[model samples]
Target: MNITVHRPGELSAVDRAAWTALQSRAHLHGSPGLANPFLSPEFTLAIGHERRGVRIAVAREDGEPAGFLPFQRSATGVGRAIGLGISDCQGLVHRPGFDWNARELLRACGLSLWEFDHLVSGQAPFEAHASATFASPVIDLDQGYDTYLRHLRERSPKFIKGTLAKERRLSRDHGAVRYVHDERDPAVLTTLMGWKSAQYRRTGRSDRFAHPWIVRLLRRLFHTRADSFAGVLSVLYAADVPIAAHFGLRSERIHTCWFPAYDPAFAKYSPGLIMHLGMAEGAAADGIAHIDLGRGQKVYKDSLKTRELMVSEGWVALRHPVAFGHRARRAPVRALRNTVQTRPELFEPADKLLKRMGRIRSRGGE
Candidate 1:
């Protein structure tokens, strides 16, 4: 096997096509976990256009393109999955039987360390290196929406009835409730960003949209349309008034849910859940077979998910100062988060503290 690195945009059209072909083949022949929009060339290229230091490592076997790994390198020689925080899934796209050592792969890309969270389950070389594994929830749509609803009813009858009742009530009170599955309005996109920013602050998490590059990336993706990958923005409205919105990426077979937010004033009506149901219905109609909700635990995910996919979170490094330095810097934070995730007793207080901080920050107290 031979490896070569290129700036994402530097890849020739032929090379890009080859990379995309590999992704499609992997998704079809490999596990369903490989069917992530984040693994597409369009996504990596869009991110490359918006951010610096983005690189793609192309691996060839017998002079044919066999794999692609897109990532970013920090000045400190620490490498990370491209669009790590925003990308719900991460992995190297490869044809079946393609194999390479993670350390050698990193060295070929000129990095001492590579870190990733949300590493796709069953990713050959990296899975063994993962320090911890977690279940990434997903809503499977292969059996159609009605079948899924029946399953949901069996699992959470009250949740389904309650959410639907809210939807009916919202429509009865506010006028006709409409759901737009693929909204193209830039203003709606802007509104979703604002809501997400506020939601992040309210939850005591870093506001991703506050970073100009992230904002730019979303804007670019919103306008991006392609067969392999496309940006999808779904919205729910009552009497022509937008109540909830979601912006995610999708391929024909998979929809990866990303940023989702709703108007706080309509929280009582559960517009976000309504919007998601609409997304599932519409996505299924559009030929999507799966909706990956991404890694992390949440009550809504547990209620709606028909199944779960495992993802790994950890770092891989060589024996080097920069690699060790990266480990030392992230270890404490990782330990704290892991501990909180495993212990509900600690999580409740941590969540409360975060919410308090979020409230303070929103009020300009930070």
Candidate 2:
């Protein structure tokens, strides 16, 4: 395979078309995970516009396009998945049977190490380097929304009943409740980001929206419209006031849920859950076959997911001093985190401690 590196914006029309074609072929040939919008060229281009260091490695065989790997590189030669912290899916989008050495690819790109958290399945070459794998919860809508609802009811009747009851109560207490699946208003996007930022601080997590690049990227994506990639904003409202909203990326067949938050004032109503249900219904209607909730452990995901997909986390490294140092510095921390995340006994206490820390931090800020 012949590999060439280019900035995401430097890709020619031929390269972009080949990238899209490869993605589509992968999806049609049973790798539905490639249908995620995060893996699309448009997403890479969007990130390139908002942030520096975004590049794509286009591989060709016999002078024909073969594969594409989009990533962000730091000055020290450390590479990460494009939109590393935010992208839910990561992998090389290549034609079936296309194969290349990971180290060779890294060398060609001048990367000493490539780190990824949510590497999608079917990545055989990279799979060998994965230190751990996690189940990514997903809501399958292939059988339609009604079928999924029936399955959900069978699995957790009480959860469904309770959430619906809360919705009724919310409507009665506030004004009539309603949902908008694809909200286009930019102001509403700002409101969603505010809620998400506050929630992040309240839960002892870094506020993603605090970064100007991320904010600009999302705003740009909000207006992006394409057949294979688009940003979808779904909102749940009470009498014209937004209570809960979600901003996620979607392709023709897959909707990957990204950021979701609800007004704490309506916490009693479980507006986030209500908004998810609305998203499911709308996604199904829009011909989306799956709603990928992404890799993580959450009560809501457990309650709503129809099944889970496997995603790996690890780094592919070339035998270089930088790669060795990177692994040495990160391995111990990652091992401890994996242990805590996999064991409920440790995870619960750690979560409580984090919440306490968050409360203290919030108080300090006040």
lDDT (Cα, 0-100) at 247 in candidate 2: 96
Off by over 4 Å in 1: none
Question: What lDDT tens digits, residue by residue, belong to model 1 across residues 246-286?
Answer: 99999868998899999999999999998999998998888
lDDT of each: 0.89, 0.92
Q: Write the per-residue lDDT of candidate 2 for residues 1-366, one digit (tens) a residue.
A: 799999976899998988888776676787888878899998999989987899999999999988899999999999998988799999999887888898899999999999999999999888889999999999999999999999989989999999999999999999999999999999999999999988888888788888998999999999999887889999999999999999999988899899999999999899999999999999999999899999999999999999999999999998889899999999999999999989999999998888788788888983
Instruction: List the candidates' TM-scores in order.
Output: 0.97, 0.97
**Candidate 1, residue 112: lDDT:** 91
User: C-alpha displacement of 226 in model 1, angstroms?
Assistant: 0.6
Candidate 2 Cα lDDT to native: 0.92
Each prediction's RMSD over C-alphas, in Å, is: 1.3, 1.2
lDDT of residue 334 for candidate 1: 89
